[model samples]
Target chain A: MKSFNKKEFRHGLKRGLPIAMGYLPVSFTFGLMAVSGGLPIWMAVFISLSNLTSAGQFAGTNLILMGAGFLEITMTTFIINIRYMLMSLSLTQRLDKAMSLPKRMMVAFGVTDEIFSVASMEQGTLTFSFLIGLIIGPLIGWTSGTFLGALICTSLPESLSSAMGIALYAMFIAIIIPPAKKSRPVTIIILLCVGITGILKYLPLFRAISSGFRVIIASILGAGMGAWLFPIDQDVEKNNKQEGVNQCN
Target chain B: MQLERAFLAMILMALVTYIPRVLPIVIFRKEIKSKYIKSFLQYVPFAVLSSLTFPDIFSSTGNLTSAICGTLVALWLSYREKSLVVVAISAIVTVYLTGLFL
Candidate 1:
């Protein structure tokens, strides 16, 4: 048991390190945007700490800038983040059966795409230490980056800040490219969503809908289509592996 | 005063964000038994990722040229299975420099 616990901890930290490294630049941009958009450094940090979601934070910040109402922002965020619910659902099946409710809850809070990918890739029983490692590494990296970016924003010139802002979009391109190559459905979804968003942004009638609404509508439409086209087969190997690990324990 | 209002707004935004993050963990503690629900969950990530990527790819600026250039560069790198960091940095640099020159 002791050896098993140690191994899980080590593996968790190892997996988390790369994620933390990636999050730094991304979170830094989020912090910079938050401050530039007139939020206080503390407020920026608080938002990053509490939410820990990049795209949603960016969208929320824009909505605030656009003078969106409280209800609008809430609904927008809910729609955008509804995907996490799905991620958590998938993760529940992967979790160790012996995991306590509290531990499961804590781990679920940290279920981002990167964490989910790393966790899903693990070959054996999902341990609490592994989830802890995933959360701790990224949490530290993300918060530190936000702090650094917020502090630097005041010192930097507008032009440089704007240039650095390009990194966020760059990160998105990075995310979209890999899956797009392997999955025609994914590529088509991106193209379709982009086209629809463009049309909606330009059309006179759609101008009445807030950016938040537009995003929610676009996400629902795109996600619905993707789900219809490329369904995921639940891997029996993963379930069998978990069962085998449990029997050994 | 407006800053304070924005601060309040930021807090409100954070609260709203936390609800989605925390709710599933709290509400759906058990493994979902329904095959249909599982199937739906499986596709949610792809869809959300697509929607998130789309607007940013095009609307980073009012102009379509930078977006087009960026997309072409990104597609090329992605097709090559280039590292995400490399693809992202290359696209941004391509677009930013293009904005300056063109």
Candidate 2:
């Protein structure tokens, strides 16, 4: 509570800008989808404001639009969001131990894939202020984009919006490709994930698996294989030693 | 009743989503000891992101040709280590321009 690092926050904001921009088109599409599917504009915006998750909220909204039961929506969202468990757990390694429970809880609220990826790649431990700064822009981008898309339903040029459908995925590619190029283990993991996902998606026998589960299954298998193939013992030892020092600080 | 249903659904969805995010950060304060587990966590982001993107990316723009063009553009830019914005915007522009012909 005493240390509000404005510099770190500003750095976080700067780092988050691309994430916010990436979110605009995707959330805009979400807004358009929810409203067009007959949800109220306010409700669509509310979902974006509260959920802050891309795939989970989209799947949940689609279910609501289709009159799916509460249990179904809840389970589907939980399955899709379970990936955050890994992201959040990964983040605990980098978090400044001085960060309070309240701060961790608050920061955890914004741990989307993009934010986590950025934070994980950071050279040192993460601070609460930096995380807060990182979360705010994308949050605003996501909520406001949803509001605009809900309000401006169908008016935006079809080609432009359709083209925008690739924005989030493009950003994902941007985040992973560079790292994969440098690291052989990461390259193998990416290939494994893509191959597994393709088979699950295309093979008639596995087609019954939901998209949410597909991501979870693919991640576990891919990461599992990577870990088995390339155990990063030195990195873990260094990280643990660093965390111990941070805790003492 | 309909409004109530939507409200309930949104709240439930938000709750389910938040728990997965918060629980691990809050509960696992200590560092994981196992190198394999650490490696798995390390690789999680790339794997999750890759799984999320593929096949889905191919269908993202609603036209296979445009989507492929965009994916190629994204791969090319990102391979060169372009910023996220540059890669994304380039792919989007490529998709839009490709869509014109399709």
DockQ of each: 0.44, 0.68
DockQ of 2: 0.68
Q: Name the candidate that leads on TM-score.
A: 2
lDDT of 1: 0.65
Error of 1 at A1 (Å): 7.9
Q: How many backbone clashes does candidate 1 have?
A: 0
Q: Candidate 1 lDDT, tens digit per residue, A1-249?
A: 231376677778877776676677778877877777777888788878877777677777777777788777777776666666667766776677777767776786687766665565466567888778768888888888998888887645433344444454555555555555555665677776667766677799887875545655775676567656654445743453254211210
Q: Which candidate number has the best DockQ?
A: 2
Task: Report the alpha-carbon TM-score of model 2 versus the true structure.
Answer: 0.94
Question: Candidate 1, clashing residue pairs?
Answer: none
